[model samples]
Target chain A: QQQVKQSPQSLIVQKGGISIINCAYENTAFDYFPWYQQFPGKGPALLIAIRPDVSEKKEGRFTISFNKSAKQFSLHIMDSQPGDSATYFCAAITGNQFYFGTGTSLTVIP
Target chain B: SQTIHQWPATLVQPVGSPLSLECTVEGTSNPNLYWYRQAAGRGLQLLFYSVGIGQISSEVPQNLSASRPQDRQFILSSKKLLLSDSGFYLCAWSMLAGFYNEQFFGPGTRLTVL
Candidate 1:
């Protein structure tokens, strides 16, 4: 079974628009949630992360909104740029293991 | 600062051939290591993980196996490669301080089995 589920297999946005990708998990044991960005032929890099204690966290143009009761979290990218075109993945960590969402391919058109 | 490395960034092997992929971490000790495989434009599938030397955990039952020979060295091996084994392999490590920590990933190894 997929522990974490992400919506919108792909997304497209114009420059300066807002892009959002959402993920949901059933495991309440997850204590940490992180978002990763990956360019083609490269490793995924940590973009932003949030703990369950906080409902929201923002880093520059990237923001993570987490809802514990709903068991959901969403990543918001503001002012999307062409350079931001890449794949994004949301992951939940519990114990020493990580459960990842399938992934979302985001494209920003200039 | 710590960094991870994976050798033979790209590999192409015929079916039934033996395979070995190596991953190492520098400037860190006793890190929690992980191995993942990803199909084209797909999500990451956790294959194996290790928290300590000589300690390994398999998340999925497959033809592949993993070993942690040292504090920072992790290896993935397959006695006989299958066409289904073709994919991008990734190595990641996180601090052992607590259950929750950011994972650092290596560039990844692309394996093509004919």
Candidate 2:
């Protein structure tokens, strides 16, 4: 069973435009939600993370809007740049284990 | 400051061959270590995890096996490689502080089995 589900397997946006990716989880036990960005031939890096207590968290141009009641969270990138073109993964953690969503590939067209 | 290392960035092996991938963490002790496999353009699948030396937990059953001989060393081994085993292998480590910790990932190793 997939504990976390992500939508839009791929995305494309023009430079300076807004890019969004969303994820949903069924496990209420999940308390920590983190987003990771991965470039080709490299390891995924920790982009931003949010705890369930917060409704939203923003870091620079990246923002994570989390809805506790809906069991959903979304990543928003403002002023998307070509350098931001990569794969994004949303993960949820419960206890010591993590459940990941099947990544979303984003392309920022310059 | 902590860093993770994975060896043999790339590997190509014939079917039925033996395989081994190594991962190590530096600048930290008693970390929670994990192994994951990602297929081409796919999500990561958790393979194994360990919280201490000689303690390994397997999430999936297959030809693959993992061992933690040292506090910071984790090894993935397969007695006989299969074509289905071709994928990118990743090693991650997180502090044993609690559940709120974020995992640090290594560069990963790409394995191709013919």
Candidate 3:
């Protein structure tokens, strides 16, 4: 299958709280996984990415926890702020094709 | 830096109208190109991809088609658009130099069919 399913269509977090979003894919051929962050009326920007060879990768306050055995990955935000409110997307790439998750809208209330 | 662009930020068409959307990339040569469509609050759906000039592989079959005439130009066209052919169109590109496949997206085009 080429589907990358994401969970929690929407989430609400408070200031200084951690926000988590999950995604799972069926195609095992995928080796590159990347998460994207998008603001209102703008294109999605690359956030953080990880390879299946590693279980986790962190960039500043954003981290990707990847599980090879479960064919799943997740994005975790540390000490989320109100400006972090936006839609996030997870994508799986094979060679030239990419499969994307449904996306998650996150809101951080101050 | 590299940038991807899509034309006519927004469009509205009738059901029987023909459609054409343009996408171009700057600062990159021989990059892999892609076309995607997204519904309101939904994820991006891959429509087609091109590896080189005149080479196109479609992932979904609907009332749409794609073409790559030059190295950095990709176009999405339909002879006759249907009511369901309206959505947010995005163009993206990634370097084919190696295994790195992080795609960069464009501002996106909103199409409304009435």
Candidate 4:
């Protein structure tokens, strides 16, 4: 069974628009939540992370909104650009293992 | 700074052929190492992880196996290749202090079994 589930396996947005990717988890023990952005033929890179202690965390145009009670987290990309097109993965770490969602493919049309 | 290295960025093999892929980490000691496989249109699947030298935990059963002979070196091996093994392999490391709260990954190796 997949411990973490992500919605909207694919997304398309226009330039200067917003792109949202969401994920939900079943394990309450999970504390650290991180989102990774991966380009084709490259390794996934850390995008933004948020803990349950905070409801939201933002870096530049990227923001992570986490809801502890609902056990959901979402990534919002403001002013989406063509370069923002890539695959995004949301992961939850518990103990020494990490559970990652399937993934979301984002496309930003200029 | 810490960095991870994976060898033979790409590989092609035939059925029943032997396979070996190597991964190494720099600027850290006794790091928790992991091996993950990404299949087409699928999520990153954890294969094996090691917290110390000569120790490994397998998450899935397959023809693949892993070994950690040294603190910073990890190797994935297979006695015979299978067509289903074709995919992207990623190596990652995490500091034990954080207990896997954060991890870094290697560039990944693309394997094609024909």
- Which prediction has more favorable TM-score, 2 or 3? 2
lDDT of 3 by residue, B1-114 (tens): 888999979999999999999999999899999999988887888899999999999989898999999999999999999988888999999985676779999999999999
Interface RMSD of each: 1.0, 1.1, 1.0, 1.1
Docking class of 3: medium
Residue B32's lDDT within candidate 2 is 93
Please identify model 2 stretches exceeding 4 Å from their true place: none
The first chain of model 1 has a TM-score of 0.99
Error of 1 at B79 (Å): 1.0
- Tens-digit lDDT track of model 1 for A57-76: 99999999999999999999
Worst 10 residues of 1 chain A by lDDT: A92-101
Chain A only: list TM-scores of all candidates. 0.99, 0.99, 0.97, 0.98
**Candidate topping DockQ:** 1
C-alpha-based local distance difference test score of model 3? 0.92
Per-model chain B TM-scores are: 0.97, 0.97, 0.96, 0.96
Instruction: Encode model 1's per-residue lDDT on B23-83: one tens digit a residue.
Output: 9999988999999999999989899999999999999999999999999999999999999
In candidate 2, what are the lDDT values of residues A1-110, reduced to their tens digit?
Answer: 88899988999999999999999998899989999999988888999999999999999999999999999999999999999999999999877878888999999999
Docking class of 1: high
Residues B1-114, candidate 2, lDDT per residue (tens digit)? 889999999999999999999999999999999999999998889999999999999999999999999999999999999999999999999874864588889999999999
True lDDT of residue A97, candidate 3: 65
